[model samples]
Target: MSDTQPATSQTAAVRFEDFGLSADILRALADQGYIHPTPIQAEAIPIVLQGRDVMGAAQTGTGKTAGFSLPIIQRLLAHASTSASPARHPVRALILTPTRELADQVADNVKAYSRHTPLRSAVVFGGVDMAPQTVALRAGVEILIATPGRLLDHVQQKTLNLSQTQILVLDEADRMLDMGFLPDLQRIINLLPKQRQNLMFSATFSPDIKKLAGSFLQNPVTIEVARSNATADNVTQVLYKVEEEAKKDAVTHIIRERGLKQVIVFSNTKIGASRLSRHLEKEGIKASAIHGDKTQAERMTALEAFKQGTIEVLVATDVAARGLDIAELPCVINYDLPYNAEDYVHRIGRTGRAGASGDAISLFTDKESRQLADIEKLIKHNISRLQLSGFVPARSMDRRPRYEESEERGVQAGRGSQYGRGAYGSRKEKVDPWFLKPYEPSAPTTKADDNGGAPQSSSKPQKAKVAALLGGVPKR
Candidate 1:
């Protein structure tokens, strides 16, 4: 019932060979250096083989793809067909992802894991021609990995059919929901046969996610490998309390000083990614930016370049958060704290992958204090402070390294608390005397003299002006 508890298979068979995986799958896994099953893999694979709905939660880099892929491949190969009809291989499995990168990644893994098997798999996503995807569909494929929008497009074109799908997998379900694909996911789910096995995988199991799983899953066995939005322990996490102006230097310095070859730096926006990349280039670092503005081809090209070690640093937005798998990536830098706290886990997950030790570095400013607090609260672990050699926060801020403590105790501006007193040094906070006083009708009395003995009512008439350009009495 709980993902934390080791499954019977987990305790019984810690190695991949003991899982009774197809020889083909075992060979493929061995080729990929996958000797041991991850916790999620060990737990979920057996349940998936039993044909049960699985709602799984784990931190990023917990081998989720293999957990689902291995069993799905085994199940498909168990019923391999010998018919020669083009439609004989009618897509029996459909994997829905929010982004094209993930679709491609999952399909590659499926193909790799099923290398020695005769199973055929194809991937379809947006940002490419429909004709090629249509051609692939016409030839027939047993497994299809796709994005929701593009799948809907193929449906509209009468080129793809989910009616025969026997299994459904929503990889990164939380991300799909984050990308606003829940309605599209529901639409796709409606197209598939309701009796098919359903599997939902995500890094976090929020209430919304549980609700989403409830709508389709048939008494799913919940597998929570880690706490919701949890990060991995293998990653060395640190926070650099930096000034806004010093962020660029901090990132470049970290990369150069650490001698990190492969790094993914996450920014809050497209412009931020581009700007940082350009700055990194000026500092002699081979960097590239990937975001929504780039075409699919361009994004793929940049990602490939980064993966190939041609691009030293991959600067990107949240679009790459759910996908962008780089094996043994050394470090991940957060140029800006994520607006959503849960994303912090996803961003750092990029580095600590495949059981490899990695580093998660974040640049923080006073402005990002709230975001930092939110991240700490969601992860339930405070990030350790890291100081840069020969680099202290610019004195303009005159602020100490902050985590959640300041945000918790600090009062709002103009309230009963310190606002800019210590940091601004010698500059007192300007108090609005008029705003401080509560509004009340003036005491009705005659106009009072300097002696404060008597008051007199002297009414001043207001001047009238034209109300329109055409000329008219403004008011009575």
Candidate 2:
């Protein structure tokens, strides 16, 4: 099947059934309550089924996982011979993710999609015992979803093999680069077969991502569902300027005032996430923090509690929350602005998933104005300004100009002095030490003709002349 164009108003809508999927796979979709294909899915499925490489850019809630997984599953099933058994191959497809959470989520989706087929899949990640992963590989699974670190560990141990992999997916390729996993990704790509299909998906394609794609992909089809760095149209963004000290109070106030039932609050540091969660809990709002430091059990427990409404808020670092799938989540709070501008899209993507309307709130301190500016530039939209009642900013009272704005005055004061202002009223001129010395030459001393006698030392010490030369030597 060839790739199909996006549906127009007069055209009939394309359903998953129109893609020639197996009966069992369609049954699984029905069980999951999926009737229509998302935009990414509608465009990517046909091209992928045609055995072509696809590079897709879509926001978080666009059902991109199914867009790639469903077609891969159907193609694999179509190629499977009736007499062949499912356990014959140890692996035929490999999916690499940046974080363990995303790996597990993708693995779950692949498993769910391939349920009716006679294929098996497993997920491998760090922060757990490797013996189980080894056992699963030995049992001969067909698909493997893994993180770069743990997957490399298995490859080095000679326990897992990728010689037979037919499809390769780098989900969230931008995040992989952000976590400094480019070298690992390259190593894994080197291990896979050269003829395999490649699919790279991300919320935003940065310059580094473009460079990576040039190296990995062949002549491929590029599918972009929205503009670059653009957030979902359904999400409403707002910013609150507050002091650094009173940020927690402001967040708590907003939650109480709005009566938000479920929310995800993002923090930059692990300690900050934990501290904020504790403060919220003390203020009678149930919350928990999830980060890389937490054990697998602890992370899973917190996620389950939050999903079940036992916890009202989740305080998470960027790495722990990427690729988290929560249905009907309404609010996302940037308790701390992300260090990277691209992460703003992924963070807010957790809400407004599956075509649902949502809201994102960011708390910006006076010091974080530049970060906020960068975010605005990336998103290409102005965030609505908001102020809380009874909250007065302390730094707002200071009329001191920003350092960047005072560059001219700073330069006019001095060239090499530490203090901006000189001790005298005028600027001080720097003095060179070599300029204070007199010149000397290495000319031979003339002796009297009558006496070839040795020259006697002068009674009075003659003052030594300092050399006057540019290259540190006297010219005769």
Q: How does each model score on lDDT?
A: 0.83, 0.83
Q: In model 2, which residue pairs have backbone atoms overlapping below 3 Å? A: none
Per-residue alpha-carbon lDDT of candidate 1 for residues 164-258, written as tens digits (9 for 90 to 100): 89999999898888778988988888898979999999988888888888788887887887777878889999998887868988888888888
The alpha-carbon lDDT assigned to residue 446 of candidate 2 equals 46
User: Poorest 10 consecutive residues of model 1 by lDDT?
Assistant: 401-410
* Steric clash count of candidate 2: 0
Model 1 gets an lDDT of 0.83
Candidate 2 local lDDT, 1-476, one digit each (tens): 23323322212387889888889899999989987898888888888898888888899889989988898888777455333444575578888898888888899899888887777789999988999999888877778899999999999999998998999999999999888899999899999999999988888989898788878887668888888889998999999888776788888888887899899999887767887899899999999999877997789899999999999999998889998898999999999888788889999999999899999999998889888989999999889997777665344333322122111112222223333334444555557889888887655554333466777544455557887667775666
Q: How many residue pairs clash in each candidate?
A: 5, 0
Q: Which residue pairs in candidate 1 collide?
A: 446-455, 446-456, 447-455, 447-456, 448-455
Task: State in Å the error of residue 402, model 1.
Answer: 26
- TM-score winner: 1
Model 1 CA deviation exceeding 4 Å by range: 1-9, 82-84, 392-476
